[model samples]
Every structure is written in structure tokens, then in C-alpha cells.
Target: MTVTHALEGDVLRRQDPELADLLLGERERQASTLQLIAAENFTSPAVLAALGSPLANKYAEGYPGARHHGGCEIADVAERLAVERAKALFGAEHANVQAHSGSSAVLAAYAALLRPGDTVLALGLPYGGHLTHGSPANFSGRWFDFVGYGVDAESGLIDHDQVRTLARTRRPKAIVCGSIAYPRHIDYAFFREVADEVGAYLIADAAHPIGLVAGGAAPSPVPYADVVCATTHKVLRGPRGGMILCGAELAERVDRAVFPFTQGGAQMHTIAAKAVAFGEAATEAFAVYTHQVVANARALAAALAAEGLVVTTGGTDTHLITADPAPLGVDGRTARGRLAAAGLVMDCCALPHADLRGLRLGTAAVTTQGMREAEMIRIAAFIGQALRDEASAPRVREQVRDLAGAFPP
Candidate 1:
């Protein structure tokens, strides 16, 4: 059934009309707007069914056949299915499908491998690293000594020379390769080599690209990193959760880290949903979908550049794009506000070497809704128009409404 029809027929609608109205409003908002947010997407109705299933009430607090609670036979089966599917999907020797979110997955990776005060290396926050990578206010930064590497100032790419120099000079205990805003594919092999050189564990936080990896649209870090952390959402098109992948050697450590170390009980429903998503991702149709996601992103990046935005790395190689809207007469923050007003939703992100923030857009959600490269070009145009003139917002909004209505998410 369509999302609108499902919501209308939901038991919540009859039991709690007020709350149901809010849920419907949210559904309407998603269907009516352009979901350019890099971290959001539309999970299939089947995945949604699993998330809203009776498993949500289960309180199984341990691994399969070893739960801390009773009546966990079904929960055990679901979690095991999720674990096996995840391992097969990513080609990892072992998988932990229980971390609550990407940050939690990262935390578990750190917990499994590093000790307090051990030096860790990751991309600097200013260079698109995630907070878990080592923001001073985050636990990663607070508990461990985190050295940061940066991207090249001119090319907007990772500064490999600088990374090597830092690794040799600091000899960190762990090296993390991932980012929240970087649009290029990470060189996991290079990181593995460096980690080996410094006797550091290579932790690949593949949260953003893991979905693309599942669809064979991006490179997988599972073969190189000592531990891989990823979110089930994003391009994976699953529930909002995290999972860890590792070789069999570290499987027991990883499991303990996720359970007693970082998180407690698994969300059986989300795990089941993750399994559904993994199964869907392994299909040939999903492979085509992921390739289209990248194609749409490339088209949008090119279009945004044509409109005078300074596209990061010249363009994108994946489902995400980062660009500065300064040439459009506003900073990233203002550009985001203008875009939102015009029914174009996205995020403001730090530009690698620049002082101003830039816009980060993704094609995963729109592509799921059957939007194509042509739609991306139109979106870039609307973004340019909206950024250039706030007074044109109403007209742009109407146009966006027409475009979005043509492809309901």
C-alpha cells in the first residue's frame, strides 16, 4: 500500500487521532518535498512492516541462544538471520547487527580495540570527519588523544602525504578512515597500509557509503579494515541503526564490545528490518538503483557547478555532493534556509579549506522515489534560483511542488 493509505488505515489513527495527525503530516511533508539530506532515505514498505512488528516489544539482551531474558527464541532467530545476511552482503567474516547508530558503532569499534589515552588518528572535523572521529566535545576526543589529518587545500582531496607524515610522527594506536561530508571514495587499502606501519588498528567508519557498498556501487572496506562500522540507513535503504563487520579473529571481541561494552539489548525489530534491507540490497535491481543514485549525484553536481556554486572535488563519485553557494550570493547557512523555503531540503557542511560552510546533498532518497538525472538538473536550477532571490521562493516552491508531486516518495 502507499504510505498515505497505510497511514490512513493505521490503528494509531483511530486510537490517537491527534498523534496520528502529526504522523500523517510528516508523511505529507516527505512526499511533498525534495529530500536532499545526505543521511536520509525511504525504506521499503516491507522494512517498515518489520520495524512496526511485534518484535518491538521483545527485550532480549544477549546473543542468539544466550539471551539475558526469557522467550527469546524468535528474537534469536531474527538477530542470527540479520547477522548472517549482513556478513554475506558485505563479505565480512563476522557481523554485529546491534549497535544503535553510526556513532554507537564507532564507539564500539574504539572500545573493542583501543584503550583510554591511546593516540588515535582520523580526518579532522574541519576536513569533513564525523564527530565520533574526534570532535573535542565528543567522547572520542575526550577519552583519547586524537591526531587529525586534513584534505589538500587546492584539490579538496585527502592529503595522503600529510596522512603518512602524521602516522609516522605520531604512531597512533588506531587509524579511522571515514567522513560525514567528504564526497569521494576512501582508499581503504592506503589506510590499512598506514595502520600496519604504525601498528595501529584500521577502523573504517563506512556509515555513509556502506549502503552503496552493499549495492556494489562503492568499494568495500571489509577486506582491509580491522573493524568496519556502518549505518543500516542511507544508501543501504534500511532502518536507522548501526552494525559492525570484522574478521573471525576479532569476532568475539567485537560482539562483546557491542553488547556489554557499549550497548545492551538489541532492537530486534530494527535488526529484522536490517535483514530485510540487506536481502533487498543483494538484488540486481538494487545494483541498478545504486548506480542511478551515483549518476543522479554526478548530474546534480555538474548542474550546480554550471550555476556558479563551487563544487567540492569538482564533482562527486558517489551519492553525495558538497558545494559552496557563495557565488549564488549567500553562505551555506543562508543557502540552506533559502532552499528549505523553496521546498529543497539539505544540510550545511564545513568546506575543507574554506572558512564558510557548504551545502551537502544526496540522491539516495530522490533516486528511490524514481527521480533521475533530469530531476537533479532541475533541482540544481531551483536551488540557484532560490539562493539568488528570496522573493522568488513562492514561485520556486510551486514549481518544486509540481516536480515533487510527479514522484511521490
Candidate 2:
């Protein structure tokens, strides 16, 4: 039997019957929905197998060669392989694969570099930044004094001038760059220059673009920033996990921050899955996949714009596109719900300068499922119809079902 078939068989045999039913249901749901979540993707069968492997039974509380628990030789090898693969893939001097999620990785980075009440400069939340960058409700905001910069109102793109002004005035201990919704390519070199001028460490949160970066579809911050953090699941198509990569000078500090300070006992299973993902990412197929992701996004953006929707930044240079749905006589929330009913899954986005009328669409999930420009065209047509009339939704839903049937998840 094939790997996927074997995995399904194993799940059927070992898991509780109720749980097995739930798993089957979820698989059916994925098979039927057009998942457009920018921050999500489907992992390879190898990566999934590693995540569900017996390695989950082990407990390695510390870094390799210095574990607090015994019977950790295999765990150590798994983690070491993960770290080495990450370092090679990203060309970083060091890698920490212990973070449970992207937010955890950010916390570890903060814990390693800053004390309580340090000033941090980050992108404003509504301007495409993550809450962990400095939302008032999150630890980063609560513990550190955070000042934010926004994109230009006219161009809807990051203003280096504004960033320079903020850096000079705020003088934060760290300057963060990267976003979950911004469609254009990030100017990591510009961020580095600004951070240096203010004597602040540069932290690039490339969680959204990790896959593109790995496949050379986008610029990598590893060569320019003091530290970089990313989720393994997004573009990377790994298990739900996070990693931190940095220069060798800060390696020990980052490792300690992740272990004793932020979390205890590494998730060895997730780490092994990440190793599988890194190995897959190093292949020629992954590079082609990344290229197709960007191409698909651009195609979708063009199709939506042609249908009279307002695409943010005029276009996209990456796998995500944000569009204002007000011209289509609908708001973001309404569009999100309607799309779900139509089997096209996307997200509502809020811009710092505008109200929450924009919808965010990503190509990562669909591209991983082997979608191309023709599929994007059909998907865009369905979205356009769905937003045009609440009454026309049933027909649009049928179209979605047809397209989803053509491409099984």
C-alpha cells in the first residue's frame, strides 16, 4: 500500500472508532473545501507520518548532548537533523526547532534579547502585523513598550521614511519587520539599515513567507537580520510548529531562551516532522511549487481586479492578496461567510488606514493541493458571483462544489 493508504489504515486500526470517524469527516471536509487561508497549508505525507510517529513518546528536556532526561539518543538525533536541515535550507549559522508555534518562537526571541519594559518597534497591527508583534492583549505588548509604524495611506505600502522617523524617535531595543497580510515583498535590507541606525536588533518574522523564502521565490532575512523566526506549517508545509534561526553569536542565548525560559520539554515528534519538511523543501519540486504559489496569487489578483474588486497594493508579489469587497456591495465578514458556504475558505482583513472591508486570500493551501492558474480563474469567478448577490449564492456554491470535486482538497 501507498504511504497515505498505510497511514489511513493505521489510524483506522489504532485510533478510537469515534476519533477515526472524526478524522474521516475532516478529510472529507478538506477534500470539499477550497482552503485559501494565507497562513495555512497541507503537509506532505512524510511530514505527517513523522508527526504521528512513536517519537512523540520521548521526552528530551534540553538541547542535544545536554538532555535532562535519559533514553534520549534517538530524540537527540531527530532534533539535530532538524537543526542541521534548517541551517542548510536557510543558510543560517544556527537553528532552534523547539518552539511550539510561531508565537512561541517570537516569545523566545523576545525573552532572549530583551528585559521587561524594553521599547520595541513593530508594524502596526491593522497594517498587516501580527498581534504578537505588540498587541496590547499579548505578552509582547504587556511586557514591552511597543511603538508602531504603518504603511503609507496613499500607496498602501510600507514607507521607509516613516520607519526611519519612528526608529530615530522611538529608539526601540528591537525593530520587527514582516506581516501576515501585506502583499508586496518585504524590504529586509531597508529594515536592517533602519534598525542599525537606531542601534536596535532586527527581527524578521517571515512566518508568512517561509515557504517562498525556502524556495527562493522571495528574499530571505537570514542573511540580513540579527534573528529570524517562522512557523513551519504555513508555506513550509510542515507540522504545526515554529523555529528560530540566527547567527552563531546569539545561538546559545536563543537555545536557552527557548528551553528554560519559554518552554519545557521539546516536542520531539514535531521536530522530526520539521526535519522531514526541511528535507522536502530542499527538493526541486518544492522550488517549483513555490513559484507556482506566487503565479497563482498573481493570477487570482488579476482576475479579481478585472471583475472590479479593489486589490490592495494594486497587486501582489507573494502568495497573498488583500481586496476591498465594498465595491462588490459586501463587507469582509459577509464575504467570508458567503465564501465558506460556497466552499472557498478565506479571511477578513482590517487595514490600519481603512475600515475592515478587505478580504485576504492566499494561494498556499490551494497550490499545495496542485491548483494552477486555470483553477484560480474558476475560484475568482465563484467569489465574484458569491459577493455580487446573496440570492445567487446557491449557484456559486454549486460551482465551488464542481471545482473542488475536480481537485480533491
Candidate 3:
């Protein structure tokens, strides 16, 4: 079903005009404003249809054929399709698509491999590591002994030497390599080597780059990481959910950890939507889209750097980009507010080695909306204009609205 059918249907509007109006307002906002958030993307209408399908009413509690709920025969088929498609897309020996979100996938990975109190090594939060990697507020940090590695202060890149030193000294039970705000490609092989040296399991929290990996725009972590956790959205352009990939030997352990240990009652509708996304990602057109996403990101990063934002790691190798906007006479938080007022929506992130925050944006959603490098260049200029002159907010908002209309997301 199309978005129009889902949102503009008479049933919802007749039953609750209030909720219908709210949904329509969100739809209008999405179409009118630019979505630059690093973790967001636009899924296909096919994926949306699956999400709103009858499968949503089902309550399958366990894996495929062994589900606890009755009348799940069709749910089993949908889930099996998602699993097989995921396996084929990533060339994984085993795929588990049940986890509710990327954090859930990480929790299950931890459940499958390491016990509570086991020492873990990961990139520090200041260096763009995700909360699941080792945030004090997260379960991973509280349950496990987490040692953090940092990035180079001047270069704004991962300190490989520091990671090795920490791994050898701490001798963690597992080592995770991934980041949310980092722009460069991670060296999965190097991380695998470190894990081998320390006799620790390697978990690649590839929530950000898995989409690029699917389209061959980035290196795959499947071959190196003992357990790979990723979100189906972002550049993947799927419904929002999490998945895990591992070898056949660990499949049962991963499944058990995801279902019985961490979560229950799988969402069959989302599983089916993931299957549609996996199918789309396997196409050559999707590969071209992924490549363009990188190109758009690089162009935008360069343009932003030209505007005096300190482009972290020099530029981006993936869809995501994080840059300190302090050179523009405003901090990241202030810049975010100004940009939002000017119709540019994004997020504020912690800058590596700096006390203040930075602006984090991505091209995934805009790219899915059919924007190219030229639009990215204009977007950077608009951002610059919005930041440089407070009185120009109205004009910048109009320009942003026009640009967003041209893309028609």
C-alpha cells in the first residue's frame, strides 16, 4: 500500500480525526523539511505496506516453525523469508531478524557470547561509539566491565595503537568495533587480529555501515566479526529494526539469546518488511544508490569544510558526517536550533577530544529522496547562510522548503 492509502484512508479519519490530523501533520512535515538525521532513512512503499499488513496482528513468540503462538503458519513463512534473504544479502551463515532494535541485537550478542561481569573493550563515547558499545547508562556498561579506547586528538581518527594496547592489557572477553558519529571506514581485519591476539570474541556493531556493505560500497564485517549487529534502517532503507549475523555453529545460541533471554513475541509485520528491504538491497539499482550516498556525503562534507566547519576525519567515507560548527561563530547545539528554525533538521553529537558538541548529519534520507551531490552542495551553502546571518532565517527557510519540495520526499 502507498503512504496515501495508509494515512489518508477513511477508516482512521472517520474513527479519530485527531490522530489522523496528527499523522497528516507529520507527513506534511516530512515532505516539506529536509531530514538530515544520521540515523534516519526513507523506506520503500513496499516495505511500508508490509509493515501495515495483516501480519501485524499475529503474535509469534518463537522462531519460525517452533513458535509458541497458534495461527502463526504465515508468520513462519514471512520470518523464514526474512532470514534467508538476510543470509543471502550479507553472505552470512546464519541470520537472526527478531531483535527489536540495534541495541537489542547487541544485547543478544552479549547474551550469546559473554556472561555478566565479563570484561569488554570498545571505542569510547567521546569517539563516536554507540551506547550499546559501552555507555554507563546502558545495560552493557552496567553488566560488563567495559574498557574504552579513544581516537587521536589532532587527527580525529581511531587510535589503532591505543586499541591494541588496551586489548593486550585488559584482555577483555569481547572486543567491539563500530561507531555512530565516525565518518571513516573501520578496519575490521585489524580488530579481528586484536581479538585473536587477546583470545576474545569480536563483535562488530555495524549499525551504521551495514547498508553500504550490502551494496558493496563498503567492506563487509561478516567475514571477520564473530558476531555482527546492525539496524535495518539508516542507509539500509528498511523498516526500523535490528538483525544479527553469525556462523552456523552460533545460530542456535544467537536465536536463544534473542528470544528467550532478551525479548519475546516477535513482530512479524516488521520481519516481513525487512525481507522486502533485503530484496531491494540486492538489486543493482540499490548498489548505485549506495554509491551515490557516499558521493553525496563526500561532497557535502567538503562543502561544509569549505564553510569553515572542522570536518572530522577530513571527510566522510560513508553516508554519515560529523563536523564541529564552532568556526561558524556558534556551537553545535546553537547551530542545530538555528538550522531547525531555518528548516534544516539534524542532530548534535559529542566532538572527539572537545568539550563542546558537533553537528551530525547524513545523506541517506535525502539520497533516498533522489537528491544528488549538487543538492548536497546547495544544502551546505544553505546551512552556512542559516548560521552566518540570524536575520536571513526566513529566506533560508523558504529556500529549504523549495529544495525539499523539489526532492518531494
TM-score of each: 0.99, 0.97, 0.99
* TM-score, model 2 to reference: 0.97
Tens-digit per-residue lDDT, 304-348, candidate 2:
998778999898999999999888888899889988887788899
- For lDDT, candidate 1 versus 2, the one ahead is 1
Model 2 — which ten-residue stretch has the worst lDDT?
A: 1-10
How many times do residue backbones clash in model 3?
0
Give the per-residue lDDT digits (tens) of candidate 3, residues 327-369: 8899999999999999999999999988999999999999999
lDDT of 1 by residue, 1-409 (tens): 2566667976878899998899888988887889999999999999998998999999989899999999999999999999899988999999999999999999999999999999999999999999998888999989999999999989999999999999999999999999999999999999999989989999999999998998889999999999999999999999999999999999999999999888888899999999999999989999999999999999999999999999999998899999999987899998899899999999999998789999999999999999998999999999988988899999999999899899988
Predictions: Cα RMSD each: 0.9, 1.7, 0.9
In angstroms, give how far residue 144 of model 2 lies from its true place: 0.6
**Whole-model alpha-carbon lDDT for candidate 3:** 0.94
By TM-score: ranked, best first: 3, 1, 2
The local lDDT score (0 to 100) that residue 330 gets in candidate 2 is 82
Judged by TM-score relative to the true structure, which candidate is superior, 1 or 2? 1
Ranking of all predicted structures according to lDDT, beginning with the best and ending with the worst: 3, 1, 2
Q: Top model by lDDT, which number? A: 3
Would you give me the overall lDDT of model 1? 0.93
Candidate 2 stretches with Cα past 4 Å from truth are: 1-15
